[model samples]
Target: MISGSIVAIVTPMHADGSIDWEALSRLIDWHVEQGSDGIVAVGTTGESATLAMDEHKMFIKACVDQAAGRMTVIAGTGANSTSEAIELTEVAREVNADACLLVTPYYNKPTQEGLYQHFMAIADAVDIPQVLYNVPGRTACDMQNATTVRLAEHPNIVAIKDATGDVARGRELIEAVGDKLAVLSGDDATAMELMLAGGKGDISVTANVAPAAMKAMCDAAIAGDRAAAEAANAPLLMLHERLFVEANPIPVKWALAEMGMMENGIRLPMTPLSEGAQPQVREALRHAGLLK
Candidate 1:
């Protein structure tokens, strides 16, 4: 089981918006040193939408190579087109990624049946462990608990990153598919609650800046230690909320740059954290003790 705080790490980029391999390596090493349980490379937060196919493959391969077995690497291999998704998953498998995280097809807004078939087809095509990512807010396609439970029967479909942020629904999914598929919380603010209700871990945006604290909270929550988990999470509430003040990766990438972890280089369509939101993110970072 790939559990605990699996960081949905941002792909470090230069001012010109090109991949910064050196900064990426440094970030990977820092995560390992900081006790992050695993890393999700080229996921939504990694700006997978902006990266070209070649760039996507390169980032995944680079993360796998850099981690060098120190931690699990779950590559984001999702596409609205099933064939494209299969191709990406094949690449992830070829590169020996620990697993692949596939967000529900976006834009097209496939039905539950379409969702099931799409996932089933990918699982059938690739033998690698797969984690289904269901963030309706972004994808516009919500994979309901029933559909998720149905897909859980597939051996390769090992987990689901539920970003719905409904603790009640999350608990229900865990109860239904907990034994069959690991239910990982994809929403940072409600992650500890989901974990306390039998979730395995979090595919976290917050972990991008405060990995050690996220890991500690996950560890405590997974171990059923509410007090410990709450203690670790209390300081992060502001961060959990503020990082989304702008679109994702916008605020998170800015947070990383503010902490001197990366350059302030967000791609077009997604601008740098606005001047107005900068202080809010900075204060959140300071509250989390990630900045001075």
Candidate 2:
């Protein structure tokens, strides 16, 4: 039941690549006002890869405290390491996050059985609702449908964020285990279609800039009102496609900054949005009516 437009929110930063705690608070408040069903703090879009361990822990705690039950705060605790993932999930649990999202082990390319053990290990270690994340494109690790269905048996494992963008396969996964767990779409461009096909909702990067529209689309889609969902999603189609014109968050963080929501302060290794891609991103926002 943890459904609807869950934003994989970016961690707002100062121009010097430092966390902008004040901006973070403001953004969370905006989502609450805009009707986002939930948020995944420190997720991939939040630049989790570069955060110090203490920063990561504090980031999740801050989001949870700020949200204050106005909306679901799902801590993004996934790591390439199982123990690290467990430790992060434990932190989420201690801080009272609604759920923790754990991506499949990356870089090591663990086998299917290895993937199973890795997730099962974490579910065993943490007594909290857990959501699986499978973005093979980013992780070079794909959790097959069978493995996901197998993991669904664990009472604590409640959902999976399917970023594969394959609606056909997503439908298969839903039919296989939709009764046991929610299959949330992790890819925004195809999220509405997947939801119409039975996805519970989306973990959206696009929602960072257009929460109300995304929430409206999700509300319609989840309610089986395809016409309404399509109308709500039409304006955001460009946002969904353009947000990734560069790498993630790069375009999205820039979009947010353009809207005067936050500073355009991306971390090193991930620089500010390039001058070339800026125009299209701007047009995307304009098309969505998020900007004039």
Q: What TM-score do all the candidates reach, one by one?
A: 0.99, 0.99
Residue range 1-292, candidate 1, lDDT tens digits? 8799999999999999999999999999999999999999999999999999999999999999999999999999999999999999999999999999999999999999999999999999999999999999998889899999999999999999999999999999999986899999999999999999999999999999999999999999999999999999999999999999999989999999988988989798999999999999999999999887
- Model 2 residue 116 lDDT? 96
| Least well predicted 10-residue stretch by lDDT in candidate 1 | 174-183
Scored by lDDT, the top model is 1
Q: Model 2, which residues run further than 4 Å from truth?
A: none
Q: Write the residue-wise lDDT of candidate 2 on 110-194 in tens digits.
A: 9999999999999999999999999999999999999999999999999999999999999999999968999999999899989
Candidate 1 TM-score versus the reference: 0.99
As for candidate 1, its clashing pairs are none
Q: What's the true lDDT of residue 105 in model 2? A: 82
